[model samples]
Target: MAGQQVYLDHNATGPMHPEVVAAVLPYIQGGFGNPSAPYAIGQENHRAVDRAREQVAGLVGATAGDVVFTGGGTEANNLAISGAFLGRSEPMRRHLVLSAIEHPSVRETCAWLEAVHGAEVTVVGVGCDGRVRLDELAAALRPDTLLVTVMHANNETGVLQPVAEIGQLLRDRGVRFHVDGVQAAGRIPVDVAAIGCQSYSLSAHKFGGLKGTGALILRDPSGVMPILQGGHQERGWRAGTENVPGIVSMGAAADVARRDLSANMAHGLALRVIFDNLSARIPQCWRNGHAGLRLPNTTSLCCYHADAMSVVLALSSVGISVGTGSACASHSQEPSHVLLAMGLDEQAAFCTIRISTGPENTVEEARWAADQIAQAVERVRLVTAPEDIGGCGEDCPCFAHSSR
Candidate 1:
């Protein structure tokens, strides 16, 4: 029972930690009550939600009062982008800026503002290494620029942006700054006061908590408005009954992450070595994203002259979990807008696989996963090759062909 399967897609969604599960079980089964109700059980549920806020805020170096809970990262992102822009006074601010390589939630939110709300948007492009240019960011700021939103880590590349540098640049500019910390929240240490961003967003599932619960951190100076209005919930920022159990689990998970991130990063670093070596053995294998300064758990490798979906399916057969591009946007065949904006061609974009390691994976499990992946890539490459299409050394049913 110790090592039956290897899960290497933590970036897509980390497995729920047992401690978090244990803490959350009672809330789901016995502690079910609406936080808004005036009864004793409901008040108890509200306290659990408040405690979760403290845990989350502690992880980000903020007070619990500043955290506003939302449905998930997407909702948090939407609330941050749309809510902040909507809160601005007319004539004082009219422009918005975001990184081109941002998650779709941010990218799409910016687009919606421009198309639907008639706001001006400027999306700065990243270089080949998937980093936003700080100089470009400084140049783009305007007197009318209402907000600047960027991610702490790229969902596709795991490459971190210069958030503190950007924050410093915007310090005196009077522009409200927002950061999407959904991917980087628990994987890396985040200090909101030090980063100096006025607001930030995060999802529980990304960091080993249950899905459908997230938080938006807002500094009082930013004065963001609520996207929806109902009761006094989330201090009128997001209105819905507080999801007490999910919040309780998120707090439990946050506490665990704060204590265990160093060890988690170490485990990831070990797995990355095996992952990199396996990709190196393949023809034209190229590792994308930050070379050294990256998330410890993520490896985005592109196999040249092969199909990514095909390779993914082959590994899935052997119970290896992975992702091609952002799991949120995988339904679309269009190249990862994040990678493409970072200077990858369509072919390179299509050939990518994202593997993220968890603390549960052992070194042997990591190596075995690498072996299976290498074999799968080779098998798929041979099948897709025109010359090898007709003949086979050891004929096997082509899973990739059937999937296509």
Candidate 2:
């Protein structure tokens, strides 16, 4: 915000909403009493927490009692996955199913369950369009499958999964379902009951709240076990002192998202349309994910012969920000697992960049950002593969490579 930069990386994190910041300041200043205590000061803080919980629950179509605030989306996802598995009474219900393109929190937690807890995990793959194969998921479900975890919207590509359909399938099979609704909650109208997930996870940060707060909305909380064994903070499902300021801000953010849902969605769709029209002029650029089944705010495109990291750095120098993939996977040198799972080869995966817009972004900014992105891609291609610069037509290797 300090420079001439145009940020198009809302999927990674977003700036706190102005109202959320205002609402959080008072809590940060003098509301120091513990929400768990019984004194008057403590009751004031407790009320604030309760009010925030209600706001968060309302955003996702759940009751306040069903929401358990966590440190972040990662913790919420972990709680949903491990807690659901731990709740199974029958020894026969020891297996779980997951999508191949789930966030690392869900993917890694499932892996841990398999390695340390002796649970069996089956990963259903996604198609080239980046949507999970419902047929494969249905086939993967077994008599012993205890839980099925799938993300409501993909973080990298912003592909929306058919959660409602999957939920009905799991319901018919009498298995527990968990949906990581972090990317879909604020941007879309999420009805957890309609989706029919036992536990649905949402991150405040992704929707203009503070980074340290998130929630797990449990349709029924009785079956789950506490992942943290400390003081019972989140109805004994999660432990430790509550982050009062973060939680308060998260609540305010949720309120803002609820109030502005329609306008924000329209704004995001407009920005995406602008970005697509502009970026199409760049050579060797094509979007990934399903055209209609993805988030209106997101666009993932591959610019052949140009490394994603290089394009990011080049754009950064010109005061524009974008993401190669999930910010959580930023440090890894490996290609994006989401792209790879969608059938992109190693080289194509390396060349993909994710651009996501927010409510504050404008058509003018989108145009400028698109120009900068095209320039960055051309610059990277010049350095990475200079021989491919002037080559044109179907016969040229560069042309053939770009067509993919």
Which model scores highest in lDDT?
A: 2
Candidate 1 Cα deviation (angstroms), residue 40: 1.0
Residues 14-82, candidate 1: write the lDDT tens digits: 889999999999898899989888999888888899989999999889899989988888888888889
Best by TM-score: 2
Q: What is the TM-score of each candidate against the true structure?
A: 0.93, 0.94
What's the lDDT for residue 295 in model 1? 85
User: Which 10 consecutive positions of candidate 1 have the poorest summed lDDT?
Assistant: 386-395
- The C-alpha local distance difference test score for the whole of candidate 2 amounts to 0.88
Residue 188 C-alpha lDDT in model 2: 90
Go through the candidates in order and give the clash count of each: 0, 0
lDDT of each: 0.84, 0.88
Residue 124, model 1: lDDT of 89
